[model samples]
Target: MVHTHAGFAVAGRPTRTRRSAVALAVALLAVAALLVLSGCSSKPDVVPSADAASVDVAATVTVKDMTFTPATVTVKPGQAVTWIFDDGVVEHDVVAADGSFVSELMTQGSYTHVFTEAGTVNYSCSPHPRMVGVVVVE
Candidate 1:
């Protein structure tokens, strides 16, 4: 027996209750991990439309030096915002906060998303959380 500071006696070996608690904790952890991974997908929440090219892009943000050149842009409804990943050998992607858009991870490619609503959408690079940008649709 192990004596506690409060003069209570504790068992020297693990009890059945302690073993059950450990098993429960491990089971909960596995469930939590599965739930988190289930939310991930190869397809983005918002897909880039091929028609996006038909309309001219209102804003062109250059992904270089690990930052969006403009950092912010304003555009009218239905206008598109294009992100050009041209940092050369450095892979980057643009992701919207509201799940409105998501770009493919690329080193030298462009991604465009049209804003059909009037609101501000904040976004950032997945790999570089420090780099952020915003788009205000009017």
Candidate 2:
């Protein structure tokens, strides 16, 4: 009588053996490598900064009908406030009541003033006393 080894086989093909296990291991390693590579290429959402530039604060007021557009303004200390003269016919000046701040006569031009103290400063146009504005520094 003749006998054969008992393993996986088909009627017309050879049986699978240790070679199939090696193929599966290689495929799994390839997939894991792809995942690791993709994760390394991603970037963070926000960037870090150590030294940022200072900000410039400015404002404008018109002299058409002798009135300030925004009668009052609030800002941080050390911030600059600019008053622009939009009307061509009239001249204006920005002068603080307590002599805290002042600007030269602006004839269709812009005037800038920097607030260094934390307080409310009442200012008005020298030529037109009716035009009043306030700067609140915090």
Most accurate candidate by TM-score: 1
Which digits, one per residue and each the tens of the lDDT, describe model 1 over residues 13-90?
Answer: 566566788899999999999998986655455456435568768999999999998999999998898888899888
Please identify model 1 stretches exceeding 4 Å from their true place.
1-46, 49-52
Q: After superposition, how far is residue 113 of candidate 1 from its true place, in Å?
A: 0.7
Please provide, for model 2 over 17-95, each residue's C-alpha lDDT reduced to its tens digit, 9 standing for 90 to 100.
Answer: 5458778899999999999787553222221211112435654455556787788888888776767677677777777
- As for candidate 1, its clashing pairs are none
Question: Candidate 2: where is the Cα deviation over 4 Å?
Answer: 1-55
Q: Which candidate is the best by lDDT?
A: 1
TM-score of each: 0.66, 0.56
